[model samples]
Target: MAVALDIVHDTQETYRKVLTSMSRPGTISTVIGDMDNPFPCHYATFLTILTLLDREVYFHVISDGENLSKVITDYTLAQETSIENADFIIVPNGTNEEAVIDAMQKCKVGTLEDPQNSSTWIIEQNMISVTGTITLTGPGIKHTTSLHLDITAELLEMRNRRVQEFPLGIDLIFTDPVSLACIPRTTKVSLDGGVI
Candidate 1:
């Protein structure tokens, strides 16, 4: 069984965690609640969307199974749109590399004057495995902080290219059942080895 999030309190906490996590890039923040989602995606991902989405924003979900796009639309009353037009893009872990790259390419990156208008990506992963190392630095880091992540080279390359435009890139939030982390556009990410 699953319990609905306490809209008022849980959202407030989740919002705080998101803010704190983004401010301290690479740090994991615990998500406060869960929902009864039959999808393979994480509950925290659903919770995050519930807390953030509104009828005014457009959202898109990329899932191999489950009609998450329809579910989110019905729940939030937010329009279910194409990735290119969505304000938020949600994807499950291990989505096809080509599809992920295509989505990344098509999504809005915002303009220099209105960078905050860019899309936010919610990537659902089961665990933060230590297959490879990445060093993050920028607004949140004291000097530089390192983390182990199981992300693909192609995905990282896309992010690298996007962030090259500076304030015109999309922001990302990685979530699991219990915790979440972020990689804001302003953060600098460097891979330890050649690629992973």
Candidate 2:
């Protein structure tokens, strides 16, 4: 039991480092220390699963039986739930805009007192470029920053609608094979016509 506790502690630390890196765009962080599995789970996804997954947290893998989902379940010990009942949703690719939006709509909106119980969406981008002119402002950001996420227009529209709900919406984490970025519910993203 002592060893198990130590692994959990180490995982939590890695998760914290990843979150801090995401909060500050373009910043890089390494997820080191303990790992239960030897699969190719990226540092971002591994840390996310470690920090958020548990018996109480139900997760939905948007991709249809992707290898990433299997690895995630094996490492995190989180139960798979229907889209409507999930506490966390993972999108292995951002191309499925409709499915992603539907999953987001199904997430539960916790009461005003415990709004943090709401779901978190982790979207994997096929490509990430920081050269885009899109401006993001709100919450964790002091000033606007420029970054490009490889998400479809429909997904962006859905996210915009969801963000209009303020503190009652799902937060987002966008990651690639090597890097990751975050867009909390409080963030405001506006794209400039460039390929993102």
**How do the predictions measure up, each by TM-score?**
0.89, 0.77
Top lDDT prediction, candidate number: 1
Tell me model 2's lDDT, rounded to 2 decimals: 0.67
User: lDDT by residue for model 2 over 102-138, one digit each (tens)?
Assistant: 8776776555777777778877766566676566776
Which regions of candidate 1 are displaced past 4 Å? 1-4, 33-40, 129-132, 193-196
Q: What does the lDDT read for residue 14 in candidate 1?
A: 85
Candidate 1 structure quality by residue, lDDT tens digits, 1-196: 4676576877788889889989999888878444575545677787788789989999887754677777787778999888889999998776776887889999999987888888999988767532437877899889977766667767888987877897799899988877788999998888874433
In candidate 1, list every pair of residues with a backbone clash.
none
The TM-score of predicted model 1 comes to: 0.89
